[model samples]
Target: MTSAVDVVVVGGGQAGLAAGHHLRRQGLDFVILDADAAPGGSWQHMWDSLHLFSPAEHSSLPGRLMPAQPGEAYPDAGHVVDYLADYEKRYNLSVQHGTRVDAVRRNAGQLMVEADTGTWRARAVISATGTWSRPFLPATPGREVFTGRQLHTVNYRSPADFAGQRVIVVGGGNSGAQIAADLTLDGHVNVTWVTQRPPRFLPDDIDGRALFDVATARRRALEEGRSDTGGVASLGDIVAVPPVRSARDAGLLSVRPMFTRLTADGVRWDDGSHSGADAVVWCTGFRPALAHLAPLNLRGPRGHIPTDGTRVLGEPHLHLLGYGDWTGPASATLIGVGRPAREAAHQIARQLST
Candidate 1:
């Protein structure tokens, strides 16, 4: 099946939904293609214990506030999913769920979005596919030879799976710290954290709001051709979540330097000491899900296209939303995505109007 619209948005996650909200407001005829069976995107894949680092008010998408659950300080992954589902319904956005976009290309001045269910021919395309599908696992020597289990954050559901085992949580990000804390909860598993450098932990009072503010300031400074010397916390900084705080209080937050190499049984330290591990959980993060956009041939040496705000520099008709800070200031976060989405929609509307 083939259809045409003013815009076609790929990925119906928070970013795509934010873009949809603006596109609808701009009176653009668009369709948001989502591969998921339901409205929630990568949130559905996160571990059950995962909770937002910021409060509900700070984690909402564009226009609508995320209703905070009673008695909860921060929302869980399920709450976010429910909020996104309701947001899509509230706006009555045109979303084609369960449609996996296979590829996208330009044909005769029109963008063609090929999906499993149909093709979308649009004057412009917005790609918002977030990074959950493409989990990154570093290449370590003897990793393939390891006899124990190894999994990325995407496949990790619960710590019970690693109960009574010796586990190594690798990475110096929030996910790594949180998962490591979870594994040490029941005292059944031995958890060791390994990082190339010590993880940065924000003060107890700091949160996502402060980070967003700093990012916004930095963006504004760059736009004005000025230097920004502000030292602000980043998304990867540990937020001192309850579980993590408890773990630190119990002296479980200590981290080891990265191992020299992986051994069949475990990892070897720089001191030539080896520790046996039953499993290795790599919370090493992800790369953008840009396979569908490969045919566009817009990737630069960094594997990402240059963009002026959300608009692709080389292809004005194409826009990218919520990949990372490069696309827009703090665009990956729920709150940070709204401005970019709104700006992208406005740009798309103006471009198609001509």
Candidate 2:
């Protein structure tokens, strides 16, 4: 059985919720499908010590400001989960939890959303399925033969799991830096942090809020036919959060060049140097979680669905929200998702009216 709606939002995480807010304002009939049984989305699975790069006031959705946690400069993962749950309730958004979408394809003039629970036919589809589920692990030689434990950022929970082991943390992104710092803080594990390039740290004072501002400026410059001033990338990569800062200050967060291959017991660098390790953690980041959209055949050369803002190129009825800056300036972040969400909702509303 197919239930018809004006819009069907896939993935009820932060991005989905933001789109829901704007869609409701447009008075559109829509349903948000979420795979998670509860409201927190991926925040529920973040490592125990994870915290936002910005304060609560700066990180929020369209309708409400995230309430600040007392005495916390940066709200932790638990607070974010609580906020998302409360945000869903506060807005009364129509979210169908535990319904994982299997595929999305065109049926007649509308898009058919096939899911675990049932089906929905909608004039427009919004794919807000973020990258959390698709952790990327680089193809290092001899990785298959490695005898030690291997894990990705998605599998990380706490430093306790790797306690007393010699661990090598890979990648140079925020996750890699944070996890390396986290392990150092544990004081039980011997950590060797490696990256493909030298790790870049933002100024101690710079946070997500500033990065968002830079992204906005860079986006405006590009759209207006001006020279690209270079966005957040110009500042640096790592956010220099409190924990990372503390560990770096203590000389516990030293980084080395990435290893060229994995050995039976450990890893080997390009210079023929080797280090033994009991475990290896890959914080290499994630690709967009768009496997369900494979039937659409919309992927481009870079393995991404080409888009004009949030709207997918060549598919006017489909919008891809919250993938990253490609979807919008900073659409992947909590606060940054609002602009793109609103634009996508407005566009969908206009398309439906015609």
Model 2 stretches with alpha carbons more than 4 Å out: none
What is the per-residue lDDT of model 1 for residues 150-191, given as tens digits with 9 covering 90 to 100? 999998888789878999999888899899888887688899
Q: Write the per-residue lDDT of candidate 2 for residues 1-354, one digit (tens) a residue.
A: 779999999999999999999999999999999999999889999999999999999999998999999989999999999999999999999999999999999888889999999999999999999999998888889999999999999898898998799999998989999999999998999999999899999999999999999999999999999999889999899999999999999999999998889999999888998889999999998999999998889988978678899999967899999988889988999999999999999999998888
Per-prediction backbone clash count: 0, 0
Candidate 1 yields a Cα-based lDDT of 0.89
lDDT at residue 182 of model 2 (Cα atoms) = 95
Question: Ten-residue segment with the worst summed lDDT in candidate 2?
Answer: 299-308
> What C-alpha lDDT do the candidate models reach, one value each?
0.89, 0.94
